[model samples]
Target: MKILKLSYFVKLSIFLILPFLCFGQEKEQKEKPELDLGGALRFNYIYSSWKEEQKTKGGEFGYDMFRINAKASYKGIFLNAEYRLYSEAFGGGFLKQGWIGYKFNEKNQFHVGLVYVPFGIKQYNSHNWFFNITYYVGLEDDHDMGFKYLHEDEKWEYAFAFLKNAEELNFGGDTENNSSRYSYDVVGRNKETNQFNAKIVRKLGDSIQHRIGFSGQYGSLYNIDTNKNGNHYALALHYELNWNKWNLKTEIITVSHSPENKEGQSNKIIKMGAYGAPYEIAADFNMYTIGLSKKISVAWGPVSEIEVYNDFGYMQKKEKEFTDSFMNVTGLLLTAGQVYTYIDYAAGYNHSWLGGNFEDDFSTGNPDANWEARFNINIGYYF
Candidate 1:
């Protein structure tokens, strides 16, 4: 039985209004006024430990998800706001951005309340929505009602979003209790979903970069109600080169997830499940990763440039759910002292965001393995 179609909100609102009706003509601008404020201050400390074969636990912490934001403009009409603070006590901070914008210039623009989803450059998905409660850590701080249309000219950049949320939040923790009890019925329960995402980025001539995207989500799990629906995707390609003092980079990412569709948009109830479970106990899930980065500069004096990175990926559990399929490999080392002022050291191994090989509870079957031995240091100062 297959009949999953809902026109995905009219094909993502006609791909964000056909690029504003093929560049919705607009010209003439003489007025210009500005008062854009800025704010930033961050401090974080973490210590972790773990052992699997014999069982061991670990911890160490220090945090400050501090933030301050401000914005105001006249001519293109703009206004922005922010406030965040979270040091501990269940980590709660809020108000990350306030929006009000109008601009059909510099490429294109349109805005509406509480914004932040500034595609990539990494923040685990453009820093995860928004909020300004002292940069709280309870979980990406909810709040999304949606409307975005963006264009970055120079080589081509695209972004289209139509979001909605009554509820859904994730800041790590809760992968079905992390295994045991027959892998918790083979992994189940952490649901509270609602998502719809789309993205595209391209620039392939001078150094190369490419990305394609997708997103789908519908809630219910935490506390169990079972209306579930989830689908997420990605396709990636990248390359960066700069020879003179040496600099090179490479990237590849492919991911997929689909399952827990309990007759959503039914055509005879395509309840779906059992795809071998990997990728969080899939109804369907796939993964791929490859990374390489290198940078070298400072020949002598003022200590700078020295970076190296490596990554590998392989994951399993989608062989129709019988289980047993895993692979992960990773390595990273970094050093960048002078300019940008810090980050004197950084290290990693099996660094995960999807490389630890399954077991984020996969809905509850209990699969666990997340290895890491990382250290970072920074002395902060930026005028």
Candidate 2:
């Protein structure tokens, strides 16, 4: 039923956009409609080190995601929208991002609608499949429903946003399973409203680029204790540097929040979509991620660029009771034109949401929760 609903909207959007975008292609098009009709199909083979019997530790081929990227402008007014197909519970067809903006000048712009929050080192920060810990915590590349002011110059950049919620159009319904295909409302540990994101960054040096950025967010999280709103604030510092064939990215983030918990069982985890315990509480946590990437140019074969990447993230919950989790991802990526192939591996704690984001590694009985590893080979082609 959920798949049907998502599919309905996806197909409807396709029917509506195709003719309009392709209408003037054959004739002398003045101001060509900037339309990008392409998507990636992927094949994956995965293996789990500890769970030899895990169902996801095998080969699978399916529609990973299909997107329609379209933008048009006349005068100074512009419109942009991207619709994609990918989700956990159902065949999710939703906008990865969409916004309307007007350029005030060469360096200033005002945009409204769904926009990316100014919270990460880069828009798409990671070089591998699994992003940094900020993504797991609902901060990296988070698209929110809101308004924004963005500016960029040679040495400085800024972004400020007033968002209503993260992702205005969410997948329709209650999801018991935690998957990247769906939002992380599994046990409802997080409820967002009236979020404000701010950031400023500057670059120094001429040859070897050195950049530093500061980001912060303040929002209200709905709690069961009171009809009033709860408080949540996050602060992060990011540094990125590139020289020769090597690039390094690092970030340190701190976040604190106090949200109302379910009555009576304030200590127990309210498990629903995820097998792990829920963490919707008044606690603070610190996260740090550092990654290095080196590009090797290979001209002989189909591989145009051979890249090696490794990134690790550590999260320490300041509640003094919660355990810390570690995430390490390493990858070898081969890029040829618009096609990419990669072999990646990740190791993390059980029930801590690892690389195989769809599969939750939770079990019963004989405790001693240990770390697990997942290895995957991915092939993707974008048309």
Candidate 3:
């Protein structure tokens, strides 16, 4: 097995600097530390058009996952972590996010550890169970091992982060990039490293709230076989509008990756993985997404409210020879006390998770690939 070599100096620096920043605050009013623990159990039922036998049998229902969430705060320091347990088929178990943060004041805060990359939308780009295509391309809700600084006020918010790499599964010895994890990242013979990101959002209006934001990121792609580094960059413009009970979200993103691969490997595609699988994706592409949701109060038994939504995404590969990808999901979210459920009809063409084959869906997709659909319901109870 090849040895994995990480930049120890950078890791050491972060560990050394965080303690000083977290503890150096002048002693003010002493507040008691607080800790909160919560978790959720979820299940899914799916009927897929591509699965002939399953469709003939009606559908399949099974346990989806259970997850634990922890939050602790003391004075100006805080910690947040989440761990998920999935079936063996879905990457088993992994740490979804864990971070330690320090609040300098009301407007400034710093975070270190496996932190979310501030890009595009804030928490989620879509209201549906299946996120937009940007999630597959590692642009939406992606997290990395990094340090981040955030500043927010009434009208403006800003975030800057320096990410060292994707969260590493193996500490020092193993060379293979593990695919058993959440969130897509460069895998195979290449790894993501030395990434930097910046995001700024401007808030406008009160009742009819509007938010406009810009995000940019640049990172390095380290090829183990070639012993060389390539590069990647992405830029996005996003907008969010909320008026009364109606909400809208939209974003346009352009991403490019230039990987220094072995002589025979094609530069047009790179490998990315999540949930125990790795697949090739076009190295250069543009993505567009838009979603709208409206909430309605309900008097049905045990159901308090329902959110109806539609989310659509389009992926346009930069290379003319590669076929593009499309996805659309129409869904409803029902909330009743501590239980929530999602019912969705999702359709896609050349999408990795939707219906296309893993090998070529996001790569050089077949020109004649037909659209496929899935009807799914997920129910989860939280405490």
Candidate 4:
């Protein structure tokens, strides 16, 4: 067995400190503040029709999230805050987005505090509550304590962000019930001190539009050694086509990571699952997600529209000993009034987070037939 060497207070100060200083300077010169208040009380229910357990189906119903958002602006200094109370394993309910932003003009802006990492396409990754496989890889709603700068124009977009503590905000660690899980960082679940992300996007076409961007990440994963580092980078392509009442969206994302370790520092164990053990991450891993979805207006009573989507993902380590993983999901999402419903069927290796705990439950004695099925419906109400 190979063991991987496992690789804060000043960051909170840096994240919140400079923003407040700028806010204070602007606050004194501002005359009046504009305030806006809004929120959503969402209820979610899930019924799992079939899974790996060689047994009965599963069902769960309860409050998914209760969110409250507030925004205020005075003399061009803006503050946005949101908090959530959520009961979900696929996602967490915590300071969703709280930031102070300054708009230099119509095309440029700067923000600080907890903000979005501005990585993959939102539609493909956010089709359902599970948020695709990227969320488990720390690219979906993966907010960090940092500073960000954004510039957008009619045809070009540019962004840069410096972040602290990668995948530090995580949910779901219990492998006890063989639960399908959501996480902040399961693959590279460590505090990254110097994480930087940069991307430049170009828009092509008039109506049938395509947007492409090259992105890179430079970061260090620190837990065991304060000096050892891990690095990863990726490139993404997103496309959107719009018609009168329908639109098509698709995205392709590929990422690669290289982990380094010194001997004897591999004592740290992974927090959960059958994969949990002395983690040796000195190898390279590559993963990709490809997704396509179309939304059409269906004038069926109160039903506003319907979305049809299919997403696929694959991951494998460069080394031959570890297993390769993948998932195939096809589903329909229905929007009626302020509520949204998802009917999805997923098939993949037992190693998929959206599928059943495959390593724990084996349908066939052979791992090759470890394929599993999950048909689930998630209904949520917004208020």
Instruction: Write candidate 3's Cα lDDT for 202-259 as tens digits.
Output: 9999999999999999999988888899999999999999998999999999999999
lDDT of 4 by residue, 1-112 (tens): 1232221455666787999988987877565788998787755444443433323434555665677889999877899888876554534456666889999999999999
Q: Please provide, for model 1 over 1-383, each residue's C-alpha lDDT reduced to its tens digit, 9 standing for 90 to 100.
A: 12335567678889999877766533223345667655555443333233242123232334444566678788778887776665434235555456687888999887766544433222231111111111111111233445567777866666665544321223343443221110011124433234444445555544444443332223222322244444443344433444443333333333344444333432111121111232333333343333344556655565565554443333333444333222222322233342332231222222222234323333222334444332333222221
**The candidate that achieves the highest TM-score relative to the unseen native structure:** 3
Please report, as a residue range, the 10-residue window in candidate 4 with the lowest summed lDDT: 270-279
For candidate 3, the lDDT comes to 0.92
Reference-based lDDT, residue 27, model 3: 41
Find the 10 residues in a row with the least total lDDT in model 1: 126-135
Report the lDDT of model 3 for residue 322.
97
lDDT of each: 0.38, 0.67, 0.92, 0.59
TM-score for each candidate, following the candidate numbering: 0.24, 0.78, 0.92, 0.73
- Candidate 3: TM-score? 0.92
Off by over 4 Å in 2: 1-33, 54-63, 87-91, 169-190, 265-283, 355-367
**Candidate 2 TM-score to native:** 0.78
For each predicted model, how many residue pairs clash, with residues at least 3 apart or on different chains? Answer: 34, 3, 0, 8
Model 4: colliding residue pairs: 4-266, 4-279, 4-280, 5-265, 5-266, 7-222, 7-223, 7-224
In candidate 3, the residue pairs with backbone N, CA or C atoms under 3 Å apart (3 or more residues apart, or in different chains) clash, namely none
Clashes of 4: 8
